[model samples]
Target: MKVPVRKQPSWFQVLLILPGVAALVVTFLFPLLWLARTSIQPTTGHTLSLHAYARLFEDSFYWWVIGRTIFIGLLCVVITVPMAFPVALFLARSQSRWRGTLTALAIAPLLTSTVIRTYGWMVILGRHGLINTTLVWAGILAQPTRLDNGPFATVVALVEILLPYGIISILSHLSRLDTELEQAASLLGARRLQVFWRVLLPLSVPGLMTASLLVFVLAISSLVTPQLMGGGRVFVLATEIFNQTTIALDWPFAGALSITLLGFFGIFVALYQRILQRVESQS
Candidate 1:
């Protein structure tokens, strides 16, 4: 009897994964490693130290900024999710010819640069701007109430940017929903609201959670919209990092801030994954 030889894996298939692996190593892993190294390097002392981290903890202001970032992210997601669901559900259920156009309209904001969008928001919500002008024209306000450079302005702009993500996430889930189950619920004498609550909502937990996580991550890390819309009043981790890196010429402090923000999101992601896995297994 002859000894059989096992066939080796194909090189072409292996080549396909190599590019992606290399990109992750180059873009993500190396940057993270560099940041960690820089974070440990003290500015004053030649040696590596944790002085930056200690200073961050010693300053309560940094903690407040962290809270603000999270709060703004939460606020944006909370407002966007409910609003996005109806639009997403409509997109999924509608058979109208104009549905494509409507969907495009919903997603159009994302096509433009974020800075341009923020500037557009400034014009619309500014003191002497469109909203004020229109309201003044309508005799609604005696003076143009300034929402320019405020959190409300930032939230509004962020909502416009973030809503598409939420809508798309929910729409994807809605499209894959089992219509037979919905029909069964309908046949069981469940009204529209009852059918939605008892069927669609339960099925959509995964999508909603995913959307929330994505929106939160994006909103928290975003720099331009907050910078322009916040008008320097909103001092977030990103802006703080910008200041430390560019303005103060402090790389170590910036690295510490970067790692701190990264760690928070990393913990958030880990917890999210664990919870998601549990929910999926239970389901």
Candidate 2:
């Protein structure tokens, strides 16, 4: 029998990818192109200039905000990753009834609006809020402290908001993994912790890294959490972008800032992809 060559993909198959292609063009590509154009253009008129980028780089305040944004994003990821790991592990390994309840509770926050969630944090972290009131009742502190308007509180809110993503991502990986290897490791003299650290965690690194990337990107782009929790005391790149576009009425500057933010996010994603590819190669 002669082997036949496979046919090329039909037009329909090619067209099937159009919606995603169109969405990418409209949502991501167009904005990115516009931002690049605007960045080099003059602020007052349409004259081409690199003044915006030059001025942006020269300003210490802008640099500080960028640094703060990165710091907050990293802090949120660090806080969420450890907490989410156990929750994800539980969800992946637990019996049906408990798993269902825990999964729902973990994902319920994902369905809520960002504004509403930030407001909830506002209440919880307010000077006279539940935490402070409870602390006072317990006599842990002499007075209620201002936690809502600080970097720490902003990070806390971001952690809460992004925690579910980390759990869900890692949960999928953990759930899909075959337990036979782990069982064999345990049977052979490996402790439970050793099996987890060597077999389970190494296998789950891809998912964990993906979750961290998602959380970091979201945290970097977040506005409401920082705005509400920081109370104008702390400024992040996203909030600064909003202010530049709306309050300052400087689209060019805003676009430049957006381009810079996009550049940073792109660098992060590229680095993650490189690491992932290296891991895959090694494996």
Candidate 3:
């Protein structure tokens, strides 16, 4: 009787996936577990307790920072999305020559370091900087307006940094779409706007949601732009985390803040994924 032997799975497949799995576990999973553990620990003796979370709710300052962070994030998204749409459409639909050039230009800000970009904005919005000088020279204002180190300046810098993300995301979606579907819609007596609204918009929901969520998460977690632009006035969740960890030397509080922020952004991401999945199934 001849016995049949079962073939072993290839070692190459296991080798290929091992690095990614290891990286995920080491970088994200371990840190998240540590944060969760620390968040519940007592501040006094480093034992597990809910005191940090209770304290977070009791402290009005935490709530204030949370609300301000949300407000700024929404403002950034509102400004970035509409502005990026046309730019994304241009990059997606335009000829390769111009589209390539424009895409590079659009992402130029992202290529620059965040610190460098914020410094550039600082110059532009400073009292004695380009914007103020131009405004005064052109008689737009008699004196330099205090725009730097304010909510508006933070929003402006955040929007500039995150705008490229929205453009790139929507551009990827638009480029992947079938043009024939759009042509068919046009053939059915639809105008450019009509075709865009009826066909393009609905299909692009996943991408739009993705881009919005990206901007929202990035805006909320960001510290550098707010720190540089806030000038000690505006404080966000990330800044609070920084303060807790460094200035206050309160790791438990910082961990709680991290967990809270993670939960906040996690909800949005979950919602976005749910809606995106449903839309994908229907489409």
Candidate 4:
């Protein structure tokens, strides 16, 4: 018997994909090229230079900002992953009627505007706002303290904003898990915790890792939440880029900063891919 050869992609298929390709070129490729060009240009001269990068490396303030951005991103991922795990597990394992309701509640924040949500957080965490007011009323403190306009509030708002994404990523993997593997583990004298730690967690590592990356990317790339919550006190790379571009009108400097931010994000993505590939190969 002869094996059937697959047909090549037809003209229609090419046409169908052409629009998407065009859109990508227009929306992403062109801008990326432009950014690359701009990053090397000097502010005073038409000729390209490495002055921006050299200056960035030399500046202690820039280093501090970059360090803080990475720290906050990692911290947000750490906070989000553990919290999201429970919600995802509940969504995956339970057949309860409240599952849908709980899931809706978890995701409902996503429907609201991020700016509005940040504002809400501002109200909640502010010195005279809900939390502090209530605490003071109950005599928990002598006076209300400033929670708004700080790094803590920035992370808190980011956690609240990005929680659903982590839950969804893990939930997708959890939903597709083989129940029989879990049953088999249970029959093999493994306790519930043992089965989870060894079997479920291993199986779910890809999803967990993916969710963590998503959280980190969102947290690091985030401008609005950090700006609002930190109240200009938190000087992240994105906010600095915004300042360079809009406030300072330094396009070349902004481009260089953008390149730096992209480089960091790329490094993170590469590290995760390498680690995840090793994990997958072992599994």
Alpha-carbon local distance difference test for all models: 0.90, 0.90, 0.89, 0.93
Put down candidate 4 lDDT per residue, 39-83, tens digits, no spaces: 788778699898888888899999999999999999999999999
Residue range with the least summed lDDT across 10 consecutive positions in model 3: 39-48
What is the TM-score ranking, best to worst? 4, 2, 1, 3
> What TM-score against the true fold does each predicted structure earn?
0.93, 0.94, 0.91, 0.94
For model 1, the run of ten residues with the poorest summed lDDT: 5-14
| Candidate 4: count of backbone clashes, pairs at least 3 residues apart or interchain | 0
Give one digit per residue, the lDDT tens place, for model 2 in 1-283: 9899899989998899999999999999998898899889885766799898998999999999899899988888888888898889889888777778889899889999989998999999899999999999999999998788989889989999999998998888889888898889999999989999989889888888888998999999999889889898879999999999899988888988999999999999999999999988977
Give the per-residue Cα lDDT of candidate 3 at 40. 86
Candidate 2 local distance difference test against the native = 0.90
lDDT of 1 by residue, 1-283 (tens): 9889877769988898899999999999999999999989977768999988998989999999989998998898899888898999899889999999998888887898999988999989999999999999999999889888978899999998889988988888888887888899999999999999998888888888888888888899999999999999988899899989999988989999999999989987998898889878867
Q: What is the lDDT of candidate 1?
A: 0.90
Model 1, position 224, has a per-residue lDDT of 95
TM-score quality measure for candidate 3: 0.91
**Per-residue C-alpha lDDT of model 3 across residues 60-132, encoded as one tens digit per residue:** 9899989998999888888898888888888888877777888999988788888888888999999998999
lDDT of 2 at 200: 86
Q: Could you tell me the lDDT of residue 183 within candidate 1?
A: 93
